[model samples]
Target chain A: MGKDGEVDFSIIGLENEIEQIQSNIDDLENGKGGSIAIIAEQFAGKTTLINKVCSMNKNRVEMISLSSVVKDEKKLQEIEEQKQIKIIDNCHFLYRHKIGGFDIIERFLKTVTSPENKQYITTWNIHSWNFLENTHEISKYFPVQIKLQGLTQEQARQLILSEYEEGEIQFIEDPTENKEKMINFVIDNTIFLNKEIGIPHLKINYRQIKSKLSRKKIILTPEENIFENIYSISKGNPGISKAIWEQSLVYPQIKPGDIKEPCQDMELDNDESFILSILVSMQNASRSDIIEIAGDEIDIERALQVLSKKNIISSEREHYTIKPEILKCATNFLRRSRLV
Target chain B: MTMVGEESGSLSGMPSIDTGTLLSVISLLIIAYVVTRVISFLLTAFSEKVGKYRIKIKMLLPILKFSIYGYTVYYIMAKLLEVSAQELILFGGLLGAAIGFGLKDLFADLIGGIIIVFEKPYQIGDKIRVGDQYGEVNDIGIRATTITTPDDNYVSIPNYVIFTQSVSSANIGNSEMMVVTDIFLEHGSDMKIARKLLKEAVVTSRFVYMSEKHPITILTKDFPFYIRLRAKAYTRDLRYEFNFESDVSSRAWKELKKKGIKPPGANLIDSSSMPDQRDR
Candidate 1:
């Protein structure tokens, strides 16, 4: 699709969404300036799509990432003064985790929607957008709303595989016979022992079992179509599919089955779960931001440790984010617990 | 007459009863009671496990209990006593007369329960205030509705009371509930700052439900001594109504105090200057 290890942005799906945005931009160029909201779930390619749209009309559009300018009213005003089509990313940050959190969003909306010769395109997290719509009637202000759908199987495969070179890695598929052998070995090895000498003994060496399992590697070729498995597992989310693909790779070879299905049964206490729910709701947050949202009573560091041990989230520098594949699971967990 | 005697006397077109049939009827009643209790316990446990969808799980309890009890009554009459539909109708008339004379209240309660299950004025887990008792409905029984009050007291109000008293349900069936909190301040307090601070408290509260349909509103009323500020908002869940109110009120008070707003002062009476009896 492009040079090796580079994602061919053009071939990625969402042509319809891009076309609609382009038409809106065209309308803006003809003096019909209005607001449009690009709404999607976390890592559903909202940023990538906006980047592509802006790149296509680099000279005509001004890109403003909201997360960078959310607290800077002067920067916002400066961007507002420029008489050109503007694209804003992460507009949901305007809704903070505190009281009067919607004030910034309200002010931004007022400034953008004032009868003027300007058009603005904004992106938002689906949860935040829903909350704003429910509380502030945000949809009325954004007359044009574009929701990005999950990638199709073909799209997911193309997007994910585009990041890897041809013949660079080998795929591994577990054969039915080998799977049975592993299952039998695990079951036979799991034995409950009773001590007669008045001494407690740990019979199961978990590390040994883990090492044995890790050592048993089987490799296959690319013809196995394991991309379909990744796509299905990620529910055709391009970001998630790509993350799973990357995580599954072990240098020159990869095992599709080795990738854990993102924290489905991890037992989290109430505090840990609450912190996780906040993280999922906010998509990404800093430690201080989480502490503020969770309140002083909660031992946030402990909760973070628990979540990290459970592999529910990952931290990069100052920001912590849930893996794309786990985002849907975490959201469902929050919904089931009625935290949302 | 005894049930067994009545079965034997059916040939002579007269009712009679015997010890064996009486024992059978008693055993059947006990079995029905025990079975219903067991089913109820299992359902309750299941509903607790499925917390968020507990309401949907609870909807099955009334239906199941009705079916089980109805079948048990039928089984006792038709299978145990070996009575025909015609005999049931005749017996039902006599029983109706007895109920009309002595069990009117109990019968009304049962009928009221059936209506409640069908009409759904309120359901299990709904936050309802019946007369002076306000609480979440814990159980809906054939004779009474049990409510677990905020203070954790289980009150069993008769089902028939629904016919006479008004029941206020905070949440009809949805999880989200509107919570109203009131804050009082000195009459001369700044309205702008008070309103802004109270609104911020609500939107920032962990329990508050922020949605367009349930936008937080702070309305003020001028009283002689103080200004009554009522914050109308929604909580994410009905269970957090009190917590949400407490959070908003405490936060608002803190902010108001930080902004130099004070509550109404006590009224002072000048007793020293009052006319003495000797002077009069």
Candidate 2:
């Protein structure tokens, strides 16, 4: 919201999604469509759509954003019943990845199914949603599951431009234009102590990955090309696209090639991969919470250091989180190892 | 041979190889060697990268190697050396005689290799037991199949052993493998809680892989002195089979002990008081 209490943000491609959610919310009075589970990849803007829906239906919707790992259902139950439709953001925190981790989420899910006059709209991390889908059948609790799709190029452009004033930023084109190669040999410093896994080997970036990942050597580019590259890399992920724009922009001037793909090494060991998956599922975790869940078998310190050094994760004091820019890549890479 | 074509250094009517022809044969041998080595390296590297399809990709190596070697042999006889009908008959006679005599086992191994290639009872990356040697199939070579046992010992069993022995494959060609973990509890321990904890431990394991089609199963059986709580769960990858078992067992036991579930004393694990069953 603005200083005068006007709407500060606009829903771009999310209009239809927001409408579907609102329609589901409207159907709650007649007891139809059940609650909604807004599932999406990291930085795909699940919270934004929830907020937009809440803003539209202010009187009827109540919102609670879980800021950290939720180990108990008391916090959820303590919230006073006010609105017909309750929105819980970051509900992924309801479950930990331990033997008894599903208890809290299980009880919450039961409550979602129990007799009630209201519907609940919850947002969850897609990874956590997948794990729970296998373990707890979490989707059963929320009949209306909206797996949010990424934004289109035009939508991404508008959403990003909405943050800046007209003529405030420069999109400069370079006079020098060089052709790009379909294949490039990039060096990724692999951190393996064995020294025989061939860490320093040349990594061949094929045409597809090359097109998605910008060149290591950034050349000056035009405005539209820059956004195209950003969209290609972010895959229309609004948060990532916006982050790329912000990183690329230098004060008032920006170039097409300024958005550098953070080529992070994801060749992690079993412990490291497990820790990374925990972080991905939980979104963020306190250091002690991570250690406790990881168990004594895993060297949490070594794994965290490796992840931090690889730029795959960031640590602040007692908390660790996956770096947003590399989230998609890390997720895809870990999926190969069945880590996420 | 000396009585037939001794002066010309020929086997009856068969011509002796010239320097150029020998050089071409040597070059072909080099090419075949290099091709197989390069293909093996590429396949192994590609398998590791395409993690989900590692076994599927590895299953191609033996067939590819066989085809390449078969083609090389065919080309050498038909095009390079250009053997005649009579020469082929003579060669066949010599090979038959050799096989009938000292080379019978080698010939049988060759045929066994062929059978293994065409009819794959097991392939590379599969955990299988041939005779008494059981482990993951590390490499399927022409003469032998190599397996790395659970104890980390590399055991090589001849290809012919597959024919003589009963072979069992744990996971045919799938990445997910079932690992059965057993924990022996005292007769009076809480079975319900133990089973629940075991199931939870297996499902929540970092290495666990569960789906609707491939679900985790827990079973209980009564022993004379102890109750065995068994968990049958699938590890995400077969490579982590042992790790999965150890992880689940440790987690389950930790929870079980905390809940005051006791393990069978003296008679089960103790060497001196171990239970014996000789009843038919």
Candidate 3:
């Protein structure tokens, strides 16, 4: 997958979303320009989809990624002057982590609305989108909202299989028994009627011991399809599924058990877990950024080292991110613990 | 009530409590108390280790302690006393009568605790106000609920208070809580500018919960001497409620000052009014 260099920009499960965006662009071309928001979870192909739309209308649309723009009114004004359908990616970056950070979004909204001929196609993280939609009624500014759902089983299978030659990667069923057995007991009572007293007699009787066993089995497809296992683990998120597939590769054969979900069996200290959660929420963070968010009380360097050693987080050019295969797990851990 | 002798052939209905059994029961009670204390301490430590899940982990304490006590009493009654189910039921009824009459308040508190656990009026780590005592609930025991005030004062209110007075919970069971911060500006101040600044202050606060569901709201109330700008926003966590309030207030005041909006003069109102001005 890495050697492919460039990914084919065709969206798999988001064909309907792409069509809606194209229709909106068509409206912009007709001088009936309006705003549309493409919302999805982090790394759910929001940027990819936006790029695809931008490429489809290459000559007519002005594609601007928010990450590339300085968060200033002048930059927004410059973009506003461009007399074309605008595609804005990573609009959530306009939201500041500190107080009064919403000014950029406010200014951007004003600029977008002031121009009757201007139409904006924006992308946002679902969390940030929800926050904006709640605080400022951001959806009201965008007439059209298209949410990108995760890839389907078939779509994930096709995407993952595309990386390998036909029959090159064998899907082997996991031979290990993963089911857990638990014994439980239930108590019951019986009642008898006494004809002489014309009343019902309640007797507490002890029943013979009976074993009630419960077994949990891991279901696998009868046909050798490794993508189903990957989809289940990653919840059909293309990025996460791809990461799991890459991690599970054993050359010619891939076993379902080979893909070890990151941090599943690892124990993390409170500080390490909290730092991990921050990474998951922010996607990628530097040591200083994590220390800033965690305050001086936390030993962020130590926590980073510990997490890195556990392979839950990987350091790249001084920035730390949760391993992609376990992105869902990390997020789930934070949510289950109510840390984010 | 007839007393049944410990001897198998005794005709007395009252169960006999021998000295050995008494000593064993006492030992068991002491053991149960120690175990409960140890478990509570361990669970509390574990809760801290879990970070944001502390409240959920601590919630298990009451259930664990209850089970332990229940089992200990059952052992004393059934195993130690060799009491039948029918006799145990009768003894329970008699004990209930005694408790209802002689220890009514204690029993009421116990029932209140059970209700609090099941009905969940407030939970551990919830920022709640009962009567005038407002703080984060630290522990919900059978007798009383313990709350740690902002000043770190530990106040224990009897659980029965739940039945007599209204209990106000800021966040219910959620970690995020709405914090309403009020900023007063001199009369005739630019209401629009002040409102915008206050809203920005809340949204920008480090402690604020910047989510659509917890949107910041700015409202204006006019009085003779001042215009009250109220900013209602939520803190990301209940623990940050006061921090959120202070952060928004300080930021809003700074921005208001920068915008040349002044607060009402202290001399315009009575000194007594000035003393209670920051009550909210």
Alpha carbon RMSD to native, model 3:
12.0
Off by over 4 Å in 1: A1-11, A66-69, A74-83, A115-118, A166-173, A177-229, A250-256, A263-274, A297-299, A337-340, B1-31, B49-52, B85-90, B93-101, B210-215, B266-280
> Candidate 1 vs candidate 3: which has greater lDDT?
1
Interface RMSD of every candidate? 3.1, 1.4, 4.5
Sorted by DockQ, highest first, which candidate order results?
Answer: 2, 1, 3
Q: Write the per-residue lDDT of candidate 2 for residues A1-340, one digit (tens) a residue.
A: 4459764455667777887887888898677779889998878888888888888888888888897878766788666687677889999889778877767887788878888656899999999998888777887888889998988887887788887899888887744443333455564544377563433454454433665575654543476777876887788889888888888889788876576656544577888889998998888899988987988899999999988878788878789888777887888877888777
| lDDT of each residue in A1-340, candidate 1, tens digit only | 3348754654488788888999999998887747899998887888988998888888888887755325556666666455478888888777676654567877888877787546889998887787677566889888899988888877886676666788666776656543312222221111137432333333343332553576555543443446645664688777788888777777777664555445443446667877876676578888877876666657999889878866789998868888787777777777765555
Tell me how far the alpha carbon of residue A8 in candidate 2 is from the true structure, in angstroms, after superposition.
7.4
Q: What DockQ does each candidate score versus the true complex, computed on alpha carbons?
A: 0.30, 0.64, 0.21
Model 2 regions lying over 4 Å from their true place: A1-9, A174-180, A185-187, A190-203, A207-221, B1-14, B268-280
lDDT tens per residue, model 3, B1-280:
2123445535555457666778888999999989999999999887765545677777777778778887998887767777877876887899889997898889889889888888889888888999989999988887999999999999999999999999988877777788888877789798888887788777645466655466677778777777778887777678877777887787678668877899888777555554343344
**lDDT tens readout by residue for model 1, B72-186:** 8888777777787787798889989989899889999999898888888998878998998999988889899999999999999999999999988888876778887887788
Order the candidates by TM-score, highest first: 2, 1, 3
DockQ-superior candidate, 1 or 2: 2
Q: Please give, for residues A261-320, the per-residue lDDT of candidate 3 as tens digits.
A: 344434565567668765664566666556555654468888898788767889878888
Consecutive 10-residue window with the lowest summed lDDT within model 3 chain A:
A205-214
